[model samples]
Target: MTGKQHLTGKVEALEGTKILCVGDVMLDRYVYGDVERISPEAPIPVLRVKDERSMLGGAGNVARNLAALGAHVAFASVVGADEVGEEIERMLGNVPHLQASLVVEPLRRSTVKTRFVAMGQQVLRADHETSAALTSAAQTEFIDRVRGLVPDVQVVVLSDYGKGVLTPEVCRAIIDVARAAGVPVVVDPKGRDYSLYRGASVVTPNRKELAEATGENASGDEAIVALARKLIGEAGIDAMIVTRSQEGMSVVMASGEVAHLPAEAREVFDVSGAGDTVISTLAASLAGGLSLVEAASLANTAAGIVVGKVGTAVVYLDELAAKLRENELSSIESKVATLQAAQDVAASWRARGLTVGFTNGCFDLLHPGHVALLAQSRALCDRLIVGLNSDASVSRLKGPTRPVQPDIARATVLASLASVDLVVIFEEDTPENLIRSLRPDVLIKGGDYTVETIVGADFVQSHGGKVAIIDLVPGFSTTKTVEKLSR
Candidate 1:
């Protein structure tokens, strides 16, 4: 069955999209440890800190969000002249292809939110900053910084934390200039006034924010639709996406078309920065030319990935792609089997219109070369079956001293690999009988052997199965491994 794995192609298409993220950025700090007992002075749990880490938060996170998805992201924002500001600058430099045009205002204090966590739960939090509105001079300079980058960016993201960096004037100036340049704008809005983000192409607000902004508490679809339309008309915004907690997301377009995506039913470990994940994914997806509905769907998946982690987590493109692929076959263990059981499994894979491939080896001692072969072979077909040589077969082929690990151990190890879907023991020197019975669509071997010389190649070809050979990782073999152990 076709599944989310189809989006892997779309992820690859996100490479090189230029995204400009502008908004209030913050320094997110984490202190993790264990809480053994209550504190002596207070009734709170005593946390003995063991580790400390920090990351880009708020708008800086939006830059990471785009970079994580393989987009070229540049951040434009304001920071105070402090140690937290220095740390943020250093970390931003470390991110791949991420640049920033930051205005360091002397009067402002850099925003820093430090959380004290114990056993993966937040025990306490500390905030240090000023949320006062930006001065007229600062707002003008901020707009100048963002306006200079608008023409070069494919998408402009205004990530507002209500931290005063995104003043109404700054927001209007940036949106107007960006729109004039034909660049679409996305906003993670804050404050009660929807007019601040009037010209933005999309405004993402949480359920609570949506209610507070519109002063409506009706939870039904009709009520939410009515409220969203009211805001869209009054604010002159193009669309609104309400990120409802547990109830899922409702996307309302100015054209009165609404699309809702159900909340992913999974054990959410933490909801920190999930909104950042949503906006970043939306920005990248939109820059990649997906429709509003398509972009939200992809953003929804990205949010699902982040909330499963324990902190203000960001989803990487490769990890998201892998998750989609893994979702295709939920029960992978069902694919592993012995010869008799493999027949039914192969039939099941075929019935689902999936292609099957076969490979065989003694696999007495697994190494990267073996792993590479299996991974590469699996790429050729949907299902991969590893024909393992039994203990007797190994002794006959390698010598009495061989079959070091035994058949069961070798089979278990091979089956544990993500690429090897099945492991079937074969007593014969070759997998001739097994191949003839399964008749896989393709037979794979290491590049060291030719198709004519590979065992079962002729039979596979006679049955309309093709032979494939993959390049081996250099300097990797059981012989070399055993030689090192002897020393």
Candidate 2:
């Protein structure tokens, strides 16, 4: 697909999608150590500790991804009234646009997963958590909290790690409230009892969980598909997503259609929080206006970017964009994949009060006029995406010999500039559609065109955006250069 069509779905997925996450929250602790030699007492290797750190995990990881995606996230979970819980709240508070409805159950312990890493490999892991159900009072409080937020939120995400926080009663109550309010609910379910998530709009379970839940581990693909079909029918759910480690994800829709997304990560390190990332992104995108297929594709791309790093990790938009830029541009599928990977990062930057400026041109040759105009555009925004006309488009606008330089060469030159955050090629006659899809905060043109004449001026103005124009350096012009050289 072309750049225009590729980014259409992804861009639509960012319009005021507020998400509420309710489930298990855990602190991920990593103990980094060095193993030098074997101990004389036994055949075990001794590891000398160097450092330690902790991060949010499980449902908390889902919250992190939601925040990273620029969603208004309200987190509801159970934690002990201890120092660990205090630290977790502090961390949550530090994230922008995050709110919490935390319940302190004195008897329950905060869940924590501790991993020992030596020489880039995990040696062992220890989990500290409670698996017992919450008390009736606690469940009531959880339901009330969710009910209060249901009217404002667009979607609810339940991240179940088999921890005690997500009891059956609490899940049902919250789901009922969300349903009554006409909001969607997604669940990252665990264990053999999928019935707990019966009324959910969608539930994500891995291959193992699905097999165990339906008692069909050793069945064929048709059997698994049939079982998933049965579960979706019996539970009255809209969809079911089955996450297969290397094989990818299979999405079964209520329409009896199934779509499979092939995994795209080049490298895999720690798969700890990958599931949370996938489910969180999927729910947020769907709430934001993307179709189920589009949301699943975006989630798959986010997962691909995270597994390349170790431990529980989040994928930033800039890093993802850079990765996309490094890879070769091919079909529409590839372009969409790249954009999905960078969607959240771009949204986060926008949330931080950063203005995004966009401009497009043939820019066949680098001249002082081009430099001065680009520099001025960069001054108005935190980042710029320079759209370049394709070879065919450039040749059509100018003559066949007018370019004198290839499109790739021009793109390479533009990409090297410090002001250019991203470069996309358009084969069309005008960049009106591209600008409209991007919906940049500022639209910049080099010449003295009136704001009304700008292709995307109406869109920019409608969204409280502005239009800017920069004067060219008097002595320099690509046309002038070509004329002088010819003479």
Q: How does candidate 2 fare on TM-score?
A: 0.67
Runs in model 2 lying further than 4 Å from the true structure:
2-9, 218-221, 318-487
The whole-model C-alpha lDDT of candidate 1 against the native structure comes to 0.84
For residues 187-271, what per-residue lDDT tens digits would candidate 2 score against the true structure? Answer: 9998877778877888888888888888876244566577788889877778988888787788888788888778878877668
> What is the clash count of model 2?
2
Q: Give all TM-scores, in the order shown.
A: 0.71, 0.67
Across 118-209, the per-residue lDDT of candidate 1 in tens digits comes to 65567799999889888788888888888888898899999999899988888889999989999999999897899999989999998888
Cα-based lDDT for every prediction? 0.84, 0.78
